[model samples]
Target: MKQYELNTIPDEGYRQALASLLYQLADDDFILAYRGSEWLGLAPHIEEDVAFSSINQDTMGHASMIYELLASLGEGTEDELAHGRPPEERRNAIILEEVNGPGDYLIEPRYDWAFAVVRHYFYTVAKKVRMDSLKQSSYGPLAEAAVKINTELYYHLLHWQTWFTQLMNAGGEAKQRMEDAVSRVCDDFLGVLTLGPDGESMSRYGLIEEEAILASRWTEALKKPFDSTGVQHPPVIRSLRGDGRKGEHTGDLTDALHTLSEVYRLEASGTW
Candidate 1:
């Protein structure tokens, strides 16, 4: 297959498939980064709070870079793509868009640190799997983007893995919390691994690997860590909330979009 730069994509079908994949990539990081930003000043401790913020910033920057790539493909301006779309148009996995927990982030926030650790670790593992595959994408720009994104993912995986393992081994309440968090995350984690309805076309076009392959890689990567933490890996992963790739989303995404897009919406015509 011939590699395609943004302007050199020859077939309309290929262009659409590339756009779809880019949306999935851009929206996943964008929503998750927003969720991460909400945890600012709310982490259990100061050092973690700072470290976590840095990760969030990096994730958001990754999202911005993807959005810019989309813009070059004529999707829209980066700001418009990131903020102008409604929840139904988002392509992020439903699991990523879910709220951190009950209660508002600004008031009476009851954010669960255990849940955060488990979710981040699991999601980062999946992201790494996808990025590794994307490094060989037929789309030249995306392959380049994936290489850059993969560099930061190392720290993301390490940071979350450390938190996940430590909390799981702490015993007593911490252990119980971490285990419960693992179960909760498992309920929706399959959505994170899914590549949506166009997954086959994406694979056929060499945009990325098949969903099953990516899922297998993610599971293999997580096994040692899960075993060490005494957490049982779920035999089957389910997308209980619905697939975000197909544009089916939950209320969590609605709330998140409203917050993240607020500034952009306030002055849509004005420069940021």
Candidate 2:
């Protein structure tokens, strides 16, 4: 029931909580999208390559939307927030910040397709869960942004869900690889579900559903596929690496930021 617009938020504490949440949302999508793009020519097939590229584009656009909302609240311009921040200042979940697989994209690049599919599928589902709750967020701009972003999620979810389920059902090496990837993803999955220290105020302010509620919803959503696929249900997700909401990150994020900001830093401003 509590609702607020861009500049109409009731207090600085609320703004801080809102900013923290927005940064998490924006940073998660931004980095994940970049990882998706790395699969540009490396996907299983040409059609899928195109489809994945489009999905990453949409995901990056969603990040831009939230970054703009943050800028409206005096955080910084969208580009600056996307490109200027150091790794420790980022708020994305550690799992989402993880690289697709070993080897550089342009080098020998021994990437793991199973890991890429698993990671994207899990992250996309989490994004959907949050977007559903955010549609009724206390902040007006954020709620509206959620409404806009939610429309594209159906296709995103379907795409990943299909990939996840099909691979799990295939059996043999495909199934084994997916199982390994699932375990790896589950290890740090809690990073995706947590709301960090500001969680209490964020929930109390009605910005979005509480972290536990949203986490429960995400677990429930995955039940259908996990049940049908025969993969052992990972009941409890934990963050073995670190909690990214608190700005704790691995070297993967540091390297990612370097690559992500290289072009932006070269051309800091628009020119004719």
Candidate 3:
């Protein structure tokens, strides 16, 4: 086994669970950041575009950190692991890897602001829960990474929550659109909360807290703002699409994987 800069040895089970958790974290950020990258020059407003780009960059950086940890575990070098992988090899949630809207980013991209807000807001909340738990991870590297990642996430949560609330209250067309987005998001959110077949094992080994607790905390975090709006926000945790952590996903991820790896794939063996 490859050694890391940190010398803590969690049990074999804990180590394996930690690796699994890292993959989910890295993949989630990678795919969503890619989606956010697609929105780079196409946001409805310029200021929002700048703010959004910062978030995407932050997410990509976080993914890099996770990928580095994975590399330390002998998964592969970070560059090859990220650039040389095929779409089916990816493990990101389906919702995240989906396109911004009906059209492609290269052409007439009518991206939906509402969908972006809801999906990002919900995912951010879930990430906060997971990171909080990881702060107590038995593995020293993971706990340390959680501490660093938690700092950047503060801005992400605030930004997405602001957009979610503002858009929901924007009235008429905006409200309708947000509602539709909410419905779609609720349908597919199971992907984010899932921790794969080893979820229980992960919790038991202190890689993270129980999945139920994490999911509940996420719901509790969202409840306050949702209640204040007087909207019919359902409290149930729903995941219409199958869990991605278990290797189940939609074609959206396949397309995203192709694009993100495009530049890197051109010369994966060459140092850039």
Ranked candidates, highest TM-score first = 2, 1, 3
**lDDT tens digits by residue: candidate 2, 1-272:** 96888768899999999999999999999999998898899899999999999999999999999999998988888889999899999999998877788666446556788998889999888999999999999999999999999999899999999999999999999999999988888899999999999999999999989999999888889999999997667455889987899999988889899998888889978420
The prediction achieving the highest TM-score against the true structure is 2
Q: Would you list the C-alpha lDDT of every candidate in the order shown?
A: 0.87, 0.90, 0.82
Question: Each candidate: how many clashes?
Answer: 0, 0, 1
In order of appearance, the predictions have TM-scores of: 0.95, 0.96, 0.92
User: Which stretches in model 2 have alpha-carbon errors above 4 Å?
Assistant: 103-108
- Estimate, for each residue in 1-272, the C-alpha lDDT of model 1 and write its tens digit: 67888778879988888889989998999999988888999999999999999999999999999999899988899989999998888999887887887576546557888888888888899999999999999999999999999999999999998998888888999999888888788888887888888888899999999999999999899888878877776435777877889899988888888887788988998643
Error of 3 at 169 (Å): 1.4
User: What TM-score does prediction 1 earn?
Assistant: 0.95
Q: Judged by lDDT against the true structure, how good is candidate 2? A: 0.90
Worst 10 residues of 1 by lDDT: 101-110
In model 3, pairs of residues that clash are 187-240
RMSD of each: 1.6, 1.7, 2.9
Roughly what TM-score does model 2 have, to 2 decimal places? 0.96
What lDDT is reached at residue 5 by model 1? 86
